[model samples]
Target chain A: MIRFDNISKRYPEGRDALQGVSFHLPAGAMAFLTGHSGAGKSTLLKLIALLERATRGQLFLDGENLTRTGKRKVPLVRRKIGMIFQNYRLLFDRTVFDNVALPLVIAGHRHQDIARRVRAALDKVGLLDKERALPITLSGGEQQRVGIARAVVNKPPLLLADEPTGNLDPELSRDIMRLFEEFNRVGVTVLIASHDLDLIARMGHPQLRLHQGRLLNPEVLAPPQ
Target chain B: MRPPAALRVYFLRHVQVALNSLGRLYRAPLASLMTAAVIGIALALPSGLYILTDNLQRLGSQWDGGANLSLFLRHDVSIEQAEALREKLAQWPEIERLRLITPQEALAEFRQLSGFGDTLDILDENPLPAVLALKPAAEATRPEAAAALKQRLQALPQVELAQLDLQWVKRFNALVDIVQRAIWILSALLALAVLLITGNTIRLEIQNRREEIEITKLIGATGAFIRRPFLYSGLWYGFGGALLAALLLALAFVQLNAPVRELAGLYESSFRLHLLEPGQWLLLLLCGALLGLVGAWIAVSRHLATIEPG
Candidate 1:
């Protein structure tokens, strides 16, 4: 679902975020992106999400070239991927239901369809009862589950999470990772960027390791556990 | 039995956004009212001035046909001779209507109006001369034409003086013209003020909702989708401001209408304050809504691009 041909990104201030990065994750595969802080994990995920463009080389998602996509077309392209953030990034003023309903709303889904899908997604994340609760009132793990529901509500074929478990306890982190595994098992391509090497080892997903803006090596691919 | 699903959805989205914006305003009543009131005052000043000038223009046009001339007959000119002159002048194409006011009738009118009846009764001979009042034709009502008519009438063999008070009438019309132009200039400035006020308000709103905007964008919301609520908020501000301005104008009208009617009554005129017609009210509302929409559009386009998922 995602392919990068030697993608390189450089900041305007002459800082290199990613250099000579090339990878291809076939459709329906789940992978973990592991690196220390500032190891270009977020940058690579950003490239896939079209949040930022590669300074050099072409990037493709679902067989479409993202490098040549115009700014106006970015939203439509982004709709095909569900993105989760470490902070959950829920609108605190809104209820958990509203937060999860956002993607479907953006897609202009019917009201009944949105309600049905939102409940199902929330149910999948075990946040069914907290749908009407505000994100501020939810615990850290619960808030992350709300974020997960939101990301998968529209059922995008590809999901990208950036340090999604960064602020969670180890148990909560595993629960979040398990939710991702569940989505991946249903044929949704998933790529998660994290600095937690120990948690990643337990998931047993293939690893894409980076160091100082460059991929380290073609590491051994781990079968899904 | 209803609209297409897509059309309904589109319309419902707009209604949803509009109501959401209104709800936000409702939640913060004080700040919203303040901003809207400021806009209202700005809009009311120009609109009020415009209505005043419009009324003045109406009053001025009513006097357009009063461009008449009064010809004073010579002291020795007999009633028969004055009557002959009046008949002859009445035949002239320049004169629309002519009336011969006899000396006795003139004296009686002057005594009654001037409150000098006792003093006038002491005089052996009537001091007032016979006058022939002349109503100029429409074509002769122009300043130069009226002046020429006056000069011709004054040069008559049996006439001593001819007066046409067209100058002051012309001056009043010119003054009204100047005031109308001033109102136009004021309206333009106030419209700019409205735009700036709404733009600034939306700018502040965008800043406060920066995180929401960024999060929405990050989750595949288009620029237009994110802009919808802000635009609706602007619309509400402008629409509310217009309503307040209309109320203010109505209050002004009510306060001034009675005194104005009394003043007109003192002059034996039946003129009353004119209220805005339905079309004019619609225009005011439309102007407010359009300005609000544009201001919001500008603020959203400028600030939204600067905000990304970063």
Candidate 2:
């Protein structure tokens, strides 16, 4: 669902964040973006999410040109992609249920539909019992699950996670990876950025590895097995 | 037919956000009340001045009908000559009506009012002069017109002195005009002050919720969605300030009404202090709320644009 044609991003201070990166992951494929810290993994995902614009070349999502999309249409495009952050990014002041309902609320769904979908997503993430509990009271892994529930509540076709399991223990990290695999089995495209080589090797997902702002394996189009 | 789903969602979202903003204000009662009190005092000053000027204008206009000129005849002029002069002046178009008070009538009035009846009887001759009390026509009661008529009467050969009794009324009207201008200036400045206070308050709120705003934007929340709550907060501040202002105005009116009425009674006037009409109060509230909305809008547009999901 994502195609980057020789995309290069240069910061205003003349530093290249990504250089001549080209890749394509067909629809219904899940992959890992493996790179060292500051190896431009986040930048690639940001380009796909339209969080940062490419300085050169073109990028496309679902056959639509993202590089040509204007600022006003960015929100509409973003609604099609679910994003999870390493920090969980949950509003600590709100309850778990309220946190998960945010995406549906932003989409202006009917209140009843929002409640049903949010609960279903929470149940999937094993957070049904913590719906009314504040995120501050939840464990790290639980908080990450709340973030996962929020990202999936709207049923976006593409999911992007930036080191989502970075703060969890190995067992909890494995559990989070399993949840992503479950979503992929149902035909949702998933791209996760991470430096956890051990967990990624065990997961056996094709890795779009990057090195020194360049993709080391740009032609790895293997489907998720 | 029931409302469309999108419309219902939009309306419900607004109601939710508005109530949520109000609840936030309730959460910080002291700070909100202090800000609203400042706005209230600012609004009340201009409102009170406006009412005072309006009442003063009404009082001044009430005395417009009493515009009169008094012409005293020369001591050497006989009553017949005085009567002839009065008849001649009475025929002028500017004179609505004129009454000639001869020396005897003047002396009698002075004696009755001055409380010097025995002393006045001790004098062999009366010192009073024939006076013509001239009431100008309604149109000629204007200050300039009456002044011109006074000058003409003073130039008459039979008249020794002429005085326009409407001088004080003209001065009072001028004073009222100046005060009205001052009120306009004050109101404009205070309105600006209200805008700044609300803008600053909303700016701080946006800063406090910066993380929430960034996350909301990341999750595809439109600019309008992010702006709704801040705008509602501004509306609440404006409405609360206006409520407090209205209360202050009502209290001031209550405190001053009795004394004002007593003062008017002392002058044999039936004038009473009047408060704002219902529509005027409604307008003040509307203006307050509008100012708050505009202020919040400005702050939101300026700050929200700079915050992106980096």
What is every candidate's alpha-carbon RMSD to the true fold? 5.4, 5.5
**Using lDDT as the measure, which candidate wins?**
2
| Candidate 2: stretches off by over 4 Å | A222-225, B1-3, B64-166
TM-score per candidate = 0.85, 0.84
Query: In TM-score terms, which candidate is top?
Result: 1
Alpha-carbon RMSD, candidate 1: 5.4
Instruction: Tell me the tens digit of each residue's lDDT in model 2 across B201-256.
Output: 99999999999999988888888888999999999998889999999999999999
User: In candidate 2 chain B, what residue range of length 10 has the lowest lDDT sum?
Assistant: B57-66
Q: Candidate 1: where are CA atoms >4 Å away? A: A219-225, B1-3, B62-66, B69-165
Candidate 1: which docking quality band? medium
Model 2: how far is B267 from its true place, Å?
2.5
Interface RMSDs of the predictions, in order, are 0.8, 0.8
DockQ of each: 0.67, 0.68
